[model samples]
Target: MQSLSYVFPVLIMLAIGGYYVWMMQKRGQAIQNIGPAMHAFFARTGFRYDHMPPEPIEAHVHLAMQEANNWAPGNRETRYVRMYQGLPINHRQAYLYDDAGMSMSCNWSAPLPGPPRIPFHVADRSLASLGKAMREAFSNTTRCWSAKHPHAVQTGIPQIDGRFLVFGRDPNAVRWLFQQNPQLVGALLQCVEVDLWVDDRDAVFADPMQKNMNAAMGGMTGQMALGFDVAKRMELSIPVHDRMSDLLLMSVRAACQ
Candidate 1:
């Protein structure tokens, strides 16, 4: 009887775990169902998106560590796209919206060189306001900066104005990207933002949470979806994919001048 009791508990545990895994798989399918529409959306933007299932962590980590120079190697098995032929930076695992310029990919690997970092969602005034507060808090303790460029204000996209809040060990390279590529910056501002992982390296783990977080961030959008807070991960449609491609083309051409 005792052996049977033990066996029953084990069975229950297995059932529970299996059920949880099944639920998660269903949710993943629901998200991917929107892929065709997302592809079409990107197509309208004059960019090509090749949907690439997330690569193994070892591959991404090796790439990030060796060749990527400073880019974070994202999570394993988190589906994303490789975007190219249009963006200034050809990105792997870029979301459908605007190539790597504004993907909210959350497939980041931890144990990354420290000093927590939060990616600026869109470069605009609201984020700048947040940056000022952050700068005061960080106070030269780190190499982080909330970069605000006057050219952004001239863009006339109020949302794109002072949106410069960076938190990390060093954001100089990030700053350089913006300064050197004004059009890419413009495209980023127009795309939706997502939550970026910013926590102590030792605390993070490789697990389903990483994929879930990426999926959640991938599905969210809007100004409120700045990824600063968990509760703000709002459900949004991919309207910008259709709306911003032409504008980005025009802006990119103008900026080149």
Candidate 2:
């Protein structure tokens, strides 16, 4: 019985180690395949990919980091950049870490030509559950800035109002922005999940990766049930550059108008 107990532990440890190795290998292979695809996609779209640091545009970098609740410096990658309709759009990837785990984000930002306007944030209602989980798991500051601002703006369109939580300091301006720009509303609806924030200086858009987070959390829970430690991180399974770019362009055009 003593010898059998010892052998059982050895087998369990070996199983755990093997699982870890397999997961890492799978992730590495995915990165290898994704890298070239990302490069090609950007080339076709006319956006420069990873050619410059984000530091030059402080507001863009700051909003992207803050949106992700990423306190730690330097995991943020400036994935792509281009000027559209006279506004520079910056796309970035950021990682946020907390006791529960880490979450990955892809965000885009464009600096407004003039002074800051009345700030507003729009979040997909479908992500309310995931947003609730994130709020509970991370710092209160991580909560959407709209929470503090506290004025809800509803578009008359039931389809949009039903699917989004839109907040702004000025209800009239918010309503007008959407009313004047049907293309902006259409762009928002076409994407799988999107969140937008408009502060004084910039308009920022994010694909919060809610679907990826839910999938990763489920996978980790399964591993935990099998006696492995939960992997405390979420990864981007694939890039959705095309959808993201369209939303960003439409947003910038609306803001500029």
Candidate 3:
């Protein structure tokens, strides 16, 4: 009976390990299938597509994500480029790794005509769950105590102020930019689950994968959750191109003004 008990547990572990490997292979295959569709779509739209970013674009991307100490760039599988409203925009999937794990971040960036300016960052507050909120609160407190964090900029508008966590080198400039461009605030609100940053050379918009209970679940639930994640990743990889382009154009225009 003791031998039976030991054998059952070993069998179960083996089954679980086999299931995990199978799911991973399936996910990889699904991701591979995505490339052809992406290429075809970009080709039809007259946007240039590349498996890897050109050197200049890669450098700009690295600089943009460098300020956030938690994130380091990973595989940037899809790079799409096109000119709109007299500005060239680069849209790509940037995989970023942190202490927890890697996440695929959908990133869009466009250069400004003028010289470099102080950088600012925006994050959607509405997306945070209780645990994430608590973690961020603790992190913020630590940063404040250390006197190493930039203060958050509040634009008096309740909707904007409540929904976003904004940080910048100059609070007055950040507030003034939002005040002058109500349209920009409106455009920003339309972007769900997205984060924004305006760096010295370019304005960037990204939607990084958020860790959730689904990612932490186990057994059948975990398998189901991972399947959903694969589907979600595919959806984000090839979002509505026109809508994204318009959002990028409007948001950048408002930010520049």
Q: Which candidate comes out best when scored by lDDT?
A: 2
Which of candidates 2 and 3 reaches a greater lDDT? 2
**Local distance difference test, per candidate?**
0.36, 0.61, 0.59
lDDT of 2 by residue, 1-257 (tens): 98999999999999999999998776555444444444444444445544543334434333433434433463444466776555577877767676856667767778777654456677777446676667657864343323424698986777679888887888887778788778778877765665787776777876655443334345556445433121222122223444555566666556555
- TM-score against truth, every candidate: 0.32, 0.59, 0.55
Alpha-carbon deviation at 213 in model 2, angstroms: 9.1
Model 3, residue pairs in steric clash: none
Preferred candidate (lDDT higher): 1 or 3: 3
Superposition TM-score, candidate 3 onto the true structure? 0.55
| lDDT, residue 97, candidate 1 | 39
Candidate 3 lDDT over 14-97, as tens digits, reads 999999999768756655544444444444444564433344443433433332223335644557687766767787765556
- Candidate 3, RMSD to the unseen true structure: 8.7
Give candidates' CA RMSD values in order.
14.5, 8.4, 8.7
Show the lowest summed lDDT stretch of 10 residues, model 2: 228-237
Best by TM-score: 2
Superposed by TM-score, candidate 3 places the C-alpha of residue 242 at a distance from the truth, in angstroms, of 3.4
How many Å off is the CA of 153 in candidate 1?
A: 4.9
